[model samples]
Target chain A: MRRFATLALALLALGAGPRSGFETMTPELQAMQRDDFANPGMLWVAEGEALFQRQGCTGCHTPAQMVGVAARYPVFDAGRDGPIDLAGRIAQCREQRQGAAPLPTESPEALALAAYVANQSRGLPLAPDPDPRLDPARRQGEALFRERRGQLNLSCAQCHDDNAGRRLAGSAIPEGHANGYPLYRLEWQGLGSLRRRLRSCMVGVRSEPFPPDAPEYLALEAYLAMRARGLVVETPAIRP
Target chain B: MRAACAALLLWAAPVLAQPAAFQVVGDTIPASLTGTPGDAARGRAIVTTRQRGLCLLCHSGPFPEEPFQGDLAPSLAGAGARLTKGQLRLRLVDGRRLNPATLMPAYYSTEGLVRVGRAWQGRTVLSAEEIEDVVAFLVTLQE
Candidate 1:
């Protein structure tokens, strides 16, 4: 742990250089993350693949076309009135392109499909589009990351930026990057979305988490993706 | 009339606990919230526990048993020799008045906070008694 912290501190000293959560995991967990057959998140990826073929998604695009698409998400779309995250874009496709019923925020199908799409981009660095219109949303996301709003009065920056690589009780505090979406969390005992992780963090600080579908979450996601530029995507990543 | 009403209310609820109004005098609160000193043993319990106080989450202290103390704040070793009891009180109550961007939570305040969880609304993170207990334990950590 000390050696890991030294490396983490070294990275921080280099000015918030992006570090994958995989780099912070214990060797045992890291091995589990590496093994697709051993990782439980692969089960969801399998389900997502089945759903992709069954739902006629192959008509317009193949699974191969989705490679690196997750990295550029939460992009500004004038037709959508603002920025749309990867999941939002997927939901929009279901409605507008597929002419299917909207996927409920309460279901597992959305998460499954997201996992499948993001899995294709695994090992690729995050590179959100540098559109001028994304500036305001990204700035708002940055502010939210730094602003103290919870009962604990701690911001995301405080723990992640100032105190990253430190121990919080028995757990290691990673840099709070969103590079690992639909990751398998040991605490949750299942695969969960990036939004679920953010809401969990908000609740951990005793703050009122934004609603499940809040636009604020997209802004935060946009900011996190920007912050994690060059860090490899680790869909179905394992975390303790 | 308001004073008479206040007197009447106090008389009506003689056992009711009133909120202690702590005065900030130059980076310190020159009085205890409970009027008497807190039990150091009880204070120590709160500081080291995982749930209560959560001091070890960000502040490493002299508790050798707790190996994974945090590194966000300065070490708690010799805290008694460094800051006065009153000074510690103010920091626990609201350190933002001193350092606006401090990561330390205002354990004894609930004012002006945004989007506090429904279960924690209108409640301070720690009660006045808990604050005094923590301060009591902190003062015992001498060089």
Candidate 2:
């Protein structure tokens, strides 16, 4: 790890001329996910399962229905005028139907429930089933992805897709896949939702991160989940 | 009056064109360096205690004094000799300044400081003096 940091530092020194944005990884970040699951993040999933059972989520979204459910998230919801990710759907269920308070989007309770529910379909293929009926939501999500919002004037594609394998600052840009969601970020000290992850990125780019249950985030999650179609879901994965 | 206006413009221009609020010179270390032994004992306290650095939640160190720290960050057993004071300062300041995509938020950069949500807003998580102290403790880990 020390050697890796040295190599990265040397690279930074050589490239110290001019830069547009910050780097994302160093040896410190690389080691973040190596010892995952041992983190307190799993407790959220545990608690979420307890909450789910307590709330009788299986009564509506049964285990059989959920077998391939995680893979099909971020679908267009005609009701919301955007693709509603699983977290949004969960919050909706709690608020409207269950007569319960909405869970904080990035809070431990929300992350846990999302993990537990998403984990039920882990290893399932990502299969976003977008319908022509859902076109409006898809379009909204796509538009949001391309629109520059932050003070830094960056879009999601600027790093994730435009230069997928290229190194920015210090860390390499990933393929922009949502296959592993409900991920435990060592930086966050616990598990968080795909929505939370999206919100975090917004803040990173200096854009206004949406409110905990904001529709824009839900739409974005829908789009992201659709993009990961065919990839197997890996909930609660470790991220830097 | 004309000269006064020109001076005001000069100062205003520099302040206005100060580029981004944060400029990250990532890992810009001097070629020549010195070696020193760090007090792992003190580093342990800073990392483990929230009152001090509270770094244990996000990083793991080689502090034998404390048990049960997370490995979210690389071990700092030999960090003293590996990085310079300035380099460490950048990491402590806005670590994300080094990596735009970093999950590690700047411990110091208040650019995204949230007043409504944050218990401490409009302030860096740690002061420069505290960062220096933490760096000093890390630099002592060469032993």
Candidate 3:
């Protein structure tokens, strides 16, 4: 029954179809197609590349090691015993390897850098590598995904999975993957980080958002990252 | 003796002509803004100019000359008669005091601002003098 429900939901998402009319007519859409190479976010990506170079990111994540690397992220970390999404992984690197202070969860630089790195795997299938080390984290993430909260009394799956394409307050909920983050949100008036987007979901769920770098968030990210494996990356993609 | 008499005359001559200080207390009004009426020309300038009051940052108003103002706040054209002067004072003194969710910065309340090097620090954007100026101007905005 559960499998039948899942199949039905997936079909509904694909059938509900793309946003009609003004979303295509919007200036943002026009800009995305016409000038992606020179877009502000892309420019931020270049800056991130420079930061990575200057910060010696090539040491552990060598150039060859990074090809198709983003597709495997939000993987389970044995140390964390849960899912660790790309953002969580990056935070760990900054803490353990770079010896730099944790970048602010919502800062422009962090979002831009994350988007830049993620964009490397654009159009590639998400393929999170499984390891026994990640089972605990994935379980934690799955639990959080199923938990209900907010005045709406809804779970993450209620809208993102069950009603993926259904309209809620004039906006359609997408597949709810972290793939395209840190995408730009027009509502935020700037680029938003993945953790920030996660925080937004928590608020939508009416749950008091946990702080960025929280173990629960990391675990949830890990799970979504794995689920999104085989999906293409679309960093800095625009969302309502 | 002559100087003293002149000072007394100046103090007593025209109490009615001066603008009164508008006062408010946390979403409630202990006194109405019955004091010095504001100047419309000045209030218009305050709302329109970036260096002055800059009310357009949060509130929308009919500035036919400038259309690129903030969209977060409601339009404020003809705000005077629409809102009681006391209500206006409360809104200005501290919008958060009225609606905790408002992004409208408290123009008057200044208890614990940690950031430094910003204008309107330790004070409302519009001082008592400017508040009256804006109120007086808004009162004239009625259609």
Residue A32 displacement in candidate 1 (angstroms): 0.7
Question: Per-prediction interface RMSD?
Answer: 14.4, 18.5, 23.1
* TM-score for chain A in each prediction: 0.92, 0.76, 0.79
Worst 10-residue lDDT window for candidate 1 chain B reads B7-16
Residue lDDT tens for model 1, A202-226: 8777789998778889889888888
Model 2 lDDT tens row, A60-103? 77656666777887766667655667777788889988898877
Task: Tell me which of candidates 2 and 3 scores higher on DockQ.
Answer: 2
lDDT of 3 by residue, B41-111 (tens): 88677667634564654356777886445443467877876887667767766666676545455455443
TM-score of 1: 0.89
DockQ of each: 0.28, 0.03, 0.02
lDDT of each: 0.80, 0.57, 0.59
Query: How well is each residue in B38-131 modelled by candidate 1, as lDDT tens digits?
Result: 8888889978874667677778888989866767678889998899999998998889888887788887888768888776777777778878
Question: Residue B140 error for model 3, in Å?
Answer: 41
Q: Runs in model 3 with CA error above 4 Å?
A: A1-34, A59-64, B1-143
Q: What is the Å distance of residue B81 in model 2 from its true position?
A: 34
Task: Kindly give the stretch of ten consecutive residues in candidate 1 chain A with the minimal lDDT sum.
Answer: A1-10
